[model samples]
Target chain A: MLRTQQLEYTYPGNKTITFPDIQCEKGSQWLLLGQSGTGKTTLLHLLGGIRKPQKGKVYVADQELNTLSSTALDQFRGKNIGIVFQQSYFVQALTVGENLQLAQTLAGHSADSDRIKDLLSRLNIGNKIHDRTNRLSQGEQQRVAIARALVNSPGLILADEPTSALDDENCKEVIDLLETQAKEEGATLVIVTHDSRLKAFFDHKIILQ
Target chain B: MNPLTLSWKNQKDRPLQMLLTLLLFGLGVGLIALLISLNTQLDEKFKNNLAGIDLVIGAKGSPLQMILSSMYHIDAPTGNISINEVKPFLNPKHPLIKLAVPLSLGDSYKTFRIIGTTHEYVDSIFRGTVASGKRWEDLYEVTIGANVANKTNLKIGDQFHSSHGFTDDGINTHDHGDGFKVVGILNKTNTVLDQLILTNTQSVWAVHDHEAEEKQAPAEAVAADDHDHDQDHASEAAGQEDHAGHDHSGHDHADHEGHDHDTHDHADHQAAGPVMKPLIEYPDKDITTLLILYRNRTSYQTLSMPRNINENTDLQAASPAIEMNRLFSMMGVGTDALRNLALIIVIVSGLSIFISLFSSLKDRKYELALMRVMGASRSYLFFLIILEGLLFAILGYLLGLLLSHGGMALLSGYLEEAYQYEFSGWRFFKEELWLLGGSLGIGFVAALIPAFQAYRTDISETLTTY
Candidate 1:
């Protein structure tokens, strides 16, 4: 459900980084691996339509990201592309359940507390639904972030270095939770991380240089 | 979820800054509001108390003082004027004079003035009625004013001595054997008369008959003085020395029967044993001031009468309208300056809001970017900042408006007691609408810069800025 072709980008007065094409089918998990300077975050940002790629096309669910107007792209991204940032950034004022509800609202879907609670229960953080995200443990925050990403049942879920901050046991658990949630939603999961420890979890992989 | 809820959370997140901003804004709004309310109410009281008399004739002194004293009774009388000196205006047949009410001052009970004038002073000047008892008929009998009766707790048939001068505490008390009896009390007329004790001019002469004896020289004055002296002697014989003992009980039985029976009984007691002859006549004697009304205020008399009195006679005549205009002009300088300063403070409060919002916007960039990513439009974030500002404005305005009215109510109570002019605290002025608009405008202008910054928040950059 996601594709990219020769996607490249550049910062002001900085060197250009060309990315290899990415192809993924629905209900699949893929890892985009790179070192710190290899544009792993940049590629994920481009695929989420957060930035305009300078050279090539990014396609999610058959819609080209660059062809849409800025406003339309934002709407399309909210509906189809759910992104989990490296560090979980929640609107700290809202509880975890409210954060998930916000994701549904921003995605133009009506609020579904049952679906949100069910997702949290499956993620093993259901009791923490009413707790502020800041008060949650790191592993629980990561699980809540995954619940927010899958709350709208988006076709594509993009996670940027989400497991890099976890230890070995938490990392494996987070990756398993992500793949399980993605497969349950039949979504294409793309994780961009510099941590090669995640290499065993997915077969489809692209290495950025 | 919504912009309003988000903005509220944003404000609640920073309680100290919001409170400081609201206080500064409230203080500015409160000062301007208090000044506006006071200025409007004081102007209303001053205009209401003018009472339509055209000219005030008194001894030569400051025209404003004479106007304030003779017309408003808020200052000491310039000095006494002999009634003979103003006989031209006092004459009923005078061409320019419609009516002249002579006033004799220099005595008071507590803060209230005891004014000695004819019945025309009450009927014509105040246009009032006796709320209880009858108008004074005997020389020592007096009519208490509504405010005087209320403030001093004096009832009909209650006799009280009026000390010399206008001391508020009634110091340097008079030693005259018999004090003036409260024979009648006038209803509230909302004029200067409400703060006065009304008695006939002869009562004033009789009470100060000793002074009249000291200044006796003119033939007509000596005749009037003798009449007052004879009346004083008769009142003394009628047991004036026992009046204090009778009133020492604090409540008098004389007024319980609807009229002053005690004074009539004293008169009858003198008449039963010895024949006391009533005086033949009271000449147009000395008075402290004359309040003159024009026959036609729109005619040339409005201009020429005061000029004619000032240039042609020994008495000084001042038009109330002209003197009041001068007083307003003098007061306007200070009030206008204060009003302008309040406006500056309002502007500074706006700047404080701007600084507060602008600084907080820097800290909120990541949160704003998150909202943008969560499908909040650029305009939504902009409105969030604007809504926060308007919330502060609305809160400050409501509190400030309350503060001003509360302050005015307290101030009006003190002023009403000190100067018998009533000021209503519940009244609202149309200018307050402009004040509200100005405060909102300040909030809007203050928030514009921060809201603009919020609108331009770069989502990807801010999200990644950490």
Candidate 2:
């Protein structure tokens, strides 16, 4: 479960953006729609506890993220929230399996090789586990990035413009995969994007202008 | 997943930079280590051969050369002086003198010097004991040092002829009478004594006596006092007593009267072996040098003995300690320059490490931020960078130690051949442990700025920007 109320942020030079209250049930998928400069990425960062809100309350699984210390907040985010960035960035020095193992260890969980193998097999890239992330194609890298996000079995999955760079068919396929994986893990899913082609995939939406 | 593992992975990402940094660091450490080992071993050898003797008296020449030739056996003798000139110190009843050992050097066997000295020189001065056979007691008998015995393979009873000069040029070989027999082999004393062939002064004198008589026997009837022959062999015979008297012309008649009385008493014991005859009996003879030890080491008279002998007497006296200090100061200039050069190389290598890490941080920004997003703390990133630096330092240090010891082993061969002093490379010095600490400090300092940059990385900014 995830909830936020009256989230406010101020960038340098006195510009401020206030966000509407949001609530999502467990295992539900929602799309957050926003134009450029609408502070959608800022809201996602606050929800993930990657940045502190100037004025806001964010609750995930009964714990208020803003009230936690920086260290505790980092730990809570690693355990409960997973963010898939717009660009598929990875630790270039590590192979796909080692990257997944690093994510599990950083989340304060012991490495589970079997779980990693299962996740990679489900993503149809199990054979690429030992391959360096840079050696993968664009679509494969994106899929591995998604796998890294899900490796810790976080309660909330956040996809930031996950389909914006993909073709129409690939976009549909990526969205279906995100929805089905979140459902299978029983995690609440939030996708932030401005792509109009993704409108029919979700029943619930929050539109920012 | 650990900081060390991550650090190692990052280092492997840039192999060329790591190799360059390590090479620079290793070369700096290796040069310094080599200097330290050489300095320590050289000091040990020099100090060990000082052997408690207070002063060296030889012919008036370079005092350092006298000490080097007589004490260290590394240089040729500073020309020979008459045994009569040194007779006062050789007296056992002299108040200030504890022991005065005579040395007659002017010959060698296969480049190893044949030192004509008494049993006291080997036993009292060097504390040498025979490992096999017995000490030399008669003319033409030799007790070889351990290294001489091993190198020349001259076992007990084996005979070898002497060459006239210090080196084995094969031209001035002494084929007179019978070849000198190896009577004893000395134990390894780890001193200059380990490289000499010891015999009584009579054997050295008798060898030249035969050479002189052989060359002058044909010309003796024609010209009895022909001074045209070489001065070294001219002083070898009793028939050259006129040349020895000419050397004593500057002294007073009373001293001459006392010397003649002592020589008659020594002649009464001439039926005994030449080793037991008083040195005064060989008044017409010459010796290479005299090693003197004082009865009262701290006495003012003992302290002034060298200056007194240097100014008044025709002989030159040198303190081994004073001469060795002068030698060390002269050697210090070269070692200090080498040490400074090594330090500069070390500093440059530190800078090299800093540049490589700082530049590589640009390429690794995303990976570092990704670690932060995956729950690595600022301190984690900081220590990861530091661990990489430490790894480089440790690897470079080990490589440096290997290189220095290997170089020392190679250099020891050439030095041993040239100086006949044993040099070993396998010994370790305490200074090398301090070197390790210094290397670690360099690693820590070089990593400081890069690690701080990693610690200050903005995870959100870095993750979203790319």
Candidate closest to the true structure, highest DockQ = 2
**How does candidate 2 fare on TM-score?**
0.86
Error of 2 at B104 (Å): 3.0
lDDT by residue (tens digit), candidate 1, B94-119: 88778888787767788677887778
Write model 1 residue lDDT over A42-117, tens digit each, in one string.
Answer: 7888998888888999999999989988777867877888888888888776789988887787667888999999
lDDT of candidate 2 over B234-337, digit per residue (tens): 34322333223222222212223233223332333254464457678777678888999999999998888889999998888999999989988998999999
| Candidate 2 off by > 4 Å | A164-177, B149-154, B161-178, B208-278
lDDT of 1: 0.77
Compose the digit string of candidate 2's lDDT tens values, residues A1-209. Answer: 99998889898777999999999999999999999899888888888888788898899987999888767776787888888888887877789999999999888899999999999998889999999999997778878888988999999999889888888877887888899999999999999999988899999999987
